[model samples]
Target: MTGTELVIDGVTLTAGAHCLVEDVSLTARPGEVIGLVGPNGSGKSSLLRAVYRALRPATGRVGVDGADAWSLPVRQLARTVAAVVQESGAEFDLSVREVVAMGRTPHKRLLDGDTAEDAELIRSALAVVDATDLAHRSFDRLSGGERQRVLIARALVQQPSLLVLDEPTNHLDIRHQLDVLGTLRRLSATVLVALHDLNLAAYYCDRLYVMRDGKVTASGPPAEVLTPHLLARVYGVASEVIVHPRTGAPQVTFLPGAPALATRVEADPSAS
Candidate 1:
C-alpha cells in the first residue's frame, strides 16, 4: 500500500476551557515513521486524538494528503487511516479472527460478506503478528500483550495509507517490542506513533518530535533531536548522548541522582 502525507498545522486542543495542547505543528512524510515522545500528560495523546478526530481542535487543521481530515466522513477517513490505541476496550467475547476481521468494516458494505481475499488478508496479518496460533482463541481471554499483538494485526489488515498508534509497545516484552517496531519500519504506510521509550523512539523512528508542556520543543532527525541538553531541558533528566556503534543512532544514557558522581563512576573501572 502507498503512504499518505500527514500534517498537523497550528493545532490547539482543549478539555472544556482548559487547553491540553497549544499550537502544535508537525508532519509525517509519505512512507516515513515519526515518533512523538514526552513525559506523561504532555499532550502527545491529545494531539493524536485530534488527528484521528476522536477530539476536535479548538483552532487548527489536521490534513492527510493535503486535504482537511475533519472534513471527511468517518468511513472515508477510516479507510485511509488505521489506528491502534492503548485504550482499545471491548467487553464482548469475539474470537481473535473476528476481532481482526473488524478492520475490514470500512471497505465492506452493510450486506457484503467476507470474500476469499479478505480471509487471506486476515490470515496474513495474523501470521505477520505471530498470532496465527491464537486465531481460534477468545480475544477476551488473552493477556494484554497478546491483545496488543492482535490489535496491531487488525490495524495491518486495514491496509490504510496512514497508521496512527499510541504507545503501541505498552505491555510488550523486549523481543516483541522490537519485532512489532521492525514490522512497522518495513511497512509502506506513513506512521505517526507515540512512544514512551526514548531508546525505541531513537532506534525505530525516522525522525523524532519532542513535546513539552503542550508545545513542540524539538523535532528533527533522531540524532539531532536527542541531545543531552535538550533532554535535560525538556525531560528534566540529565543524560549523556552516545552513538550506537552498529546502527549509528543516537542513544541516551540517563544519569542517576548525582550527575557528577555518575560520570566519574562510569569512567572508573572499580565502580562496575
Candidate 2:
C-alpha cells in the first residue's frame, strides 16, 4: 500500500479541565516533511501523540488518507503510520535485529512465522538508518544514539505512508543528526517531526508549524515561519535568521542577552 496522508481538523485535546491542545488543525501531504516546533510545555508532544493515536482528541477528528484515523483498525493504522517517540526504554533482552523485525508484526498472522521476505525487509531498514553494523548487538547495550537508530529502522521496516518522529536528533551527535534528517528528506513518505532545533528543522523540513501554549501560532515554509519576530515571540529568545549559503534554507542563530553578549565581546574584540 502507498503511504498515507494525515489531516487534523479542529482537534482539541483536553485533560480534566485543561485543554492541552486547542483547535489544532494541519495537513501533512504525501512526500512532504512538516516540522513541529514549540517550547517545552507548548503542546508539540501532545499534538504528536494525537497523530499516533496515543491520545484521542476530545473534539474534532484526525484523518489518514481521507479516512477518519480512529475508524481505521489498529493493525491497519500501524501499517499506515509508523512513529519513533522520545521514550526508548525496552525491558526485553531482544537483539537489535529482533527489535526491528517486530515492525513486521502487523503484517503477519497471530502465529505466523517470519518469511525470507520479512528478513530482507528488516535488513534493508537497518541499512537505511546505518544500524546494520549493530544488527546482532543487544539493544540494551547500545548507546542512546544507536538505540534511536534501531528504533527508526524499526519504524522504516513498517513501510508506513506517514512517519511521525519526536525529537529524533535528541541523543545523536552532529554528524548523525545530519545523517538521520538527510535520510528522512530522501524518503518518499510524508513526515511529521517534532524538533527542538530550529536550524535542523529548517535544513530538513519542507514546511514548519510553530506552536505556542497549546495553540498553533504560525505555519508555512521554513523561510516564512522562522522569522526573527516569530522565534522571539514563541520561544522567548531573540534570534537572527539567515539564509543557508548552499541550500537557501533559513538558518537561525539565537542572540545572547546582555550579560552573555558582554562576556563574549569582552573575551574577544573581533567576536562582535
Candidate 3:
C-alpha cells in the first residue's frame, strides 16, 4: 500500500479554556518519517490526536491525502490512520493476540471471522515488533515495554497508510528502542512520531518539526533543525550538534551546564 500524505493546517486544540495546541501546521509527504520533538506539554500528542480523530480541532483542519479527516466515517478513518498513543484504556483480560486482532475489526463485517490474510498480517506484525512469544499472554500481565510493543503491532496490523505514534519509545530499553525506531524507518507508510530524545529523533526522522509552547518553532532536515542554539532556546539546554561519521546523522552532545541552565529557567517562570 502507498503511504498517505498528511497535512495539519492552522489547527488549534483546547482543554476547556486553556489552549493545548495553537495554530500548529506541518506536513508529511508520502513514505516520509517526520518527527515531533520538544519538552513536556509541547502539544505534540494533542496535534497527533487530531490526525487520528481523537480530538476535533477548534480551528483549522487535519487532512489526509487532501480529504478533510473530520468528514470521513469512523471505519474509513481507522483504516487510513492508525495510532499508538501513550494512554491505553483498560484491556481487561484480553490476550495479546486478541488485542491485536482488534485491528482487523475495521476491515471485517460484524460477524466475519479472521481470514487467512488477516492471520498472516497479525503474525507478521508480531514478528516485526518482536512480540510473537507473548502472543498468548494476557495483555494486563505484560510489562510496560512489552505492552507498548504489542500496541505497535496492533497498529501495524491495521495496514494504515499513515501511522501516528506518540512517544513510541517510552518504556523501551536501549536495544528495543533502537529496534522499534529502526523498524519504523524501514516502513513504507508515512510516519509522524513524537520523540523526547533528540538524538533518536535526529537519526530516525527524514525531517523534523520542533514544537515549543504548542507551536512549531522549526521544521527541516535533522541536521538543520537540531542545532545547539535551537536546543538551548527551545529546551533551555546547552548542547552541541555533530554529524555521526558512520551514520552521517546529527548527534547531540549535551554540555555539563545544560542541567543547571534548565534548573534556573524552571526556577524563574518568566525567564522562558
Candidate 4:
C-alpha cells in the first residue's frame, strides 16, 4: 500500500514455437507481497523474467506505476524496479560494500563519483539486510546465505518501488530463510517473489498466483488458492491443507504417493 503498483496485461512469452507463459495478467498492489508458485517447468520463472524485463513478452504489456514498463528508459526502469535474481557469481571479487554500491548505479550519471548520500544509502541498505557487519568482506568468500543477503541489500540500495526476487530463500537455513522473507515483508516496496516453499508462500504472501504448464491456474488469497483440490490437480500431489495455529494462515502438508502402511513404522522399544 506504500509502493508502486504493477499491471501486467495479456502478457505472453514464447521461445520459437513453444509458449512459455501465455495471456498472464495480474496486478501487484503497493506494499503487498505476491507469491508465485508452481512445479518445475511451470513458467513461474518465465513470468517473473517478463516482469523484470529479462524476457520480453512476445505479446502484451507490463505497466509499473501506471506507465508501460517497456516504454521507460532502461536506466529509469532500473531505478524503479530492483530485482534479486538467481545469478550470484561475481567473478571480479568485489567487496560487499562495493557490490551494494552498484545498486546506486542507476541514479548516478556515467563516471560519476559516489556522493556522501550514496554511501549513506548503501549503509542503510546493508543495515536492512543485517549485512552491515560484513560490508568489508569479500563477496566471493561469503557463504551462500551471506551472499544472498548481500544481494538483497544491493537491491534495497536501489530504493526501488517494486522488488522482484526469484528463489530468494535458496541455500538458506531455516532461520535465515525466515529472516530474509521477514525483511522482504517489512519493505514498503511492492514484492513479487517466486517460491517453491508452499508454507513460506502461504505464511508471507498477501496473495498467491499458482501457475501450471504455461498459464495461471489460480490466483487469490492463499486460503482460496491453496486448497487441497487445487494442490492435487495442479501439483499431482495429495495434500492436507490446514490453518497455521499461530498466524491462522493456510498451511499445506503433502501426503506421499506410497501407501499408508509403508508410511507408518512403529518406534522400536529396543532401539529407544
Candidate 5:
C-alpha cells in the first residue's frame, strides 16, 4: 500500500481533569515525515496517543485516508496505522521474531494462521533493521537500544500507510539514531514521530510542529520554526540557530547558561 495522509484536527487530549494538549491541528501529507518537538511535559506523547487511537480525544477528530479514526473499528484502524510506543509492556516473554510477527495480526482473519508471505515479510522487516540474527533472542533480555530496533521492525512488518512513533530513537546510539532515521526516510509511509533531538528532527522531517505547554506554538518547515527566538520562548533556552554546512537544515547550539523554565527538574507528569 502507498502512503496516505494523516490529519488531527482541533484535537484536545486530556488526562483525568487536566487538559494535556488543547485544540491542536496538524497534518502529515502522504509519504511525508512530520516531527513533534517540545520540552518534557509539553504533551508531545499525549498528542501522539490520540493519533494512534490509544487515547480518545476529548474534542476533535483524527482522520486517516479521509475517514474518522474514532469511527473506524479498532481492527480496521490497526491495519491502516501502526505505532511504536515508548516503554511498551515489560512482561512479555516473547522472542524477537514473535514480537515482530505480531505486526501481522491486524491482517489475519479470525482463526487464520500465518501465511508463507507473512513469514517472508517478518524476515524482511528484521533484515531492514539488521535484527535478523537476533530473531531467536528473548525480547525482554535485549538491551534498551536493541529492543528499540526490534520494535521498529515490528512496525515495519505491519506495512502501515501511516506510522506513529513516540521517541523512536530513545535508547539508540548516535550511529543507530542516524541509521533508524535513514530508514524512515526511505519508507513510503506518512510518519508523525515525537523527537527530542532537534537537529535530527530538522534533518529528517519535512515539516515540524513545536509544542509548548500543551499547545503548538509553531508549525512549519524546519528553517522557519527553529529560530533562536522561538527556542527561547518555548524551550526557555539560549541557542544559536545556524545553517548546517552539509544539509542546510537549522542547527541549534546551546549557549553557556541554564534554561529559564520554572521547575525545570520536575513537572507534573499528568501534563505530559
Candidate 6:
C-alpha cells in the first residue's frame, strides 16, 4: 500500500456545551508516522475520535486521500481507515484468530468465509505482534497487554491505507512497547497514534504534534517540538530533551518534583 494522505482542517469538537477540541489542524503525508503527545485530558483522544469517525467534528473536516471522511459510506471508510482505540470492549467466547478475522468483514460478504489471503494476513499480523501462539486461545482470557497486541493485529489485517491508534502501548511492558512502536515505524500505512511516552514518541514518529487544553500548542520534528520549556508549559513537568548518542533520536529525561533543577536542554548538533 502507498498509504493515504490525512488532513484535519480547522476541526472543533464539542460534547454538549463543553468544547473538547478547538480549531485543530494537522496533516500526515502518505506513509508518514505522526505522533500526538499530550497529558491526560488534553483532548488527544477526543481529537483522535474525530479522525476515526467515532465522533463528528463540530466545525472542521477530516480528509483521507483527498476525500472527506464523513462523506464516505461506512464500509468504504472502514476499508480506507482502521483504528484501534483504548476502550475495546469484551470479546466473549471468541478465539484470537476469530477476533483478528473480524478485520476482513469490510471486504467480505456476510455469508463469505475466510480466504487463503485472509488467513495469511491473519497469521502474519499475529506474528508481527508476537501473538502467534495465542491464536488458538480465547481472546477474553488474555491479559491486557496480550489483548492490546491482538487488537493491533486485527487492525493490521484490515489492510487500510491509514491506521489510527490511541495509546497502542497502554498496557504493554517495556519490551512489548518498543516492539509495537517498532512495528508501526516499519509499516507502509500512514499512522496517527497518541502516545504518553515522550521517548517512544521521539524515536518512532517522523513528526510530532503537542496538544494541550484542547488545542495543538506545538508541532514539528521531535528535536524542535520536545523542548524542556514546552514540556513544562503543556504537561506541568520539568524535563530535559537529550539526543541519544547512538541512535540520535531525542530522549526525554524528567526531573520529578523539582522544577528548578529542570533547565532547557537541547541536543548539541556539534556533539559527535
- The numbered model that scores best in TM-score is 6
TM-score of each: 0.94, 0.92, 0.93, 0.91, 0.93, 0.96
List ranges where model 5 is wrong by over 4 Å.
Answer: 258-272
What's model 5's overall lDDT? 0.89
Model-by-model lDDT, in order?
A: 0.90, 0.87, 0.90, 0.87, 0.89, 0.92
Which lDDT tens digits does candidate 6 get at residues 1-272?
Answer: 45899999999999999999999999999999999999998999998999889999999999999999999999999998999999997765999999999999999988999999999999999999999999999999999999999999999999999999999999999999999999999999999999999999999999999999999999999988988888888888888778887678888899887555567655666776
lDDT tens digits, residue span 15-131, model 4? 999999999988899989999999998998888888789899899999998998988999989989988888756554889999999999999999998999998988988887778
Superposed Cα deviation of residue 239, candidate 5 (Å) = 0.6
C-alpha lDDT of candidate 6 relative to the true structure: 0.92
Instruction: Candidate 6: give the clashing pairs.
Output: none
Candidate 6 lDDT for residue 92: 58
Estimate the lDDT of model 4.
0.87
Model 5 TM? 0.93
Off by over 4 Å in 1: 258-272
| Model 5 agreement with the true structure over 1-272: per-residue lDDT tens digits | 56889988999998899999999999999999999999999999999899888889999999998999989998898998999999585755999999999999999988788899999999999988888899999999998989999999999989999999999999899988998999998899989999999999999999999999899999999989988778888977877776766666777777767544222122233543
Q: What's the TM for model 4?
A: 0.91
Error of 2 at 258 (Å): 6.9
Give the alpha carbon lDDT tens digit for every residue of 1-272 in model 1. Answer: 68999999999999998989999999899999999999998999998888888999999999999989999988999999999987898754899999999999999999788999999999999998889999999999999999999999999989899999999999889988998999999999999999999999999999999999899999999988887778777877778877766666777789876343222111333333
lDDT of 5 at 168: 95
RMSD to the true structure for each prediction, in A, is 3.3, 4.4, 6.4, 5.2, 7.2, 1.6
Q: For residues 1-272, what per-residue lDDT tens digits would candidate 3 score against the true structure? A: 46999999999999999999999989999999999999899999999999998899999999999999999999998899999999985664899999999998999999999999999999999999999999999999999999999999999999999999999999999998999999999889999999999899999999999999999999999988887788888988777666776677887877878544321111222333
- Native-to-model Cα distance after best TM-score fit, residue 10 in candidate 1, in Å: 0.2
